[model samples]
Target: MPEIGAPHKVTHQDGGNDEISLTGLSGLAGESQTPLAHKTSHQDGGTDEISVGGLAGRQIFVPYNAKIADINEADTNKHTLNLETALSETRKIIALIAMTSRVSGSSVFWVYPNEGTTGIDLVATLRYGSTLIIKDATQRLQYSQGFANDDWDLYCFGYVVEI
Candidate 1:
């Protein structure tokens, strides 16, 4: 039987550029939100249909042809989201983030409310081994009692990449 989650395309021949592909080897030059629900819904070309909530629970009918900016960065945070530069430059906005932790045999994730300030209740995304973990970026994780920290690093609240 074939293994689950197979790669779309597996290439063995090195692309010739060592820096281009980072398969392994650590210590190497490598590496690499939300709120204000902007309700969006659409009648498929009739293939995909989804109903999303708008800011403060407002209902909006989004059509298939219309791609809405559901997450209003300006309203997401109490402070202003100076996205004019990014918006003008045309960037994908990645708002909030989520965080997660892994245990002996299971994983845990968390999500927080996005209220603008980079203080508390943020979200984050973490990657461990083969697991993609997402959790509350700023909220104190309620895990093992000893693992909790009061001074959690505040994950900057904003869209990293324009959506």
Candidate 2:
């Protein structure tokens, strides 16, 4: 369970079913790849190229859209996250990250929209400085209807891991 007032990484795999461990923190998610954005050093130490990686000391903003209606009896979008196995079609993006103390776990979580539903919106933003392993364009690890078939959009920003 996520600590009150603390942001937690919610893990969802397999499908919208078969929930797994609700406790324990692990390592980062996704496969390792070349740094998408990295910081460069200068000789005079004046200014340098800055790269962004996973959530370690960086902030990532991912926008998306989901035409889902709020539910009454466990029908709210919150239920979409209840599925530990995988997020539902409603969840457009899943922000995966490395193990950290803030969330007490290593996994992926939902990035909800801050404004009205059914339009382009900022899904989630990762606030950490770690190497971005990989990002998925699909909706969680389930029998997704596919991007071409669904009404969702993915905006991922991969930064270089600050050494």
TM-score leader = 2
Tens-digit per-residue lDDT, 1-163, candidate 2:
5457653333334343554543454454333335543332343343564434434544344332332222122111322222222223233343432211121222223333222133211223333322222223433211111122223322223222212
RMSD of each: 27.4, 30.3
Q: Please give the CA lDDT of all the candidate structures.
A: 0.28, 0.29
lDDT of 1 at 13: 33
**Model 2, C-alpha of 153: deviation from truth (Å):** 18
* Whole-model lDDT, model 1: 0.28
Q: State, as a TM-score between 0 and 1, how close model 2 is to the true structure.
A: 0.19
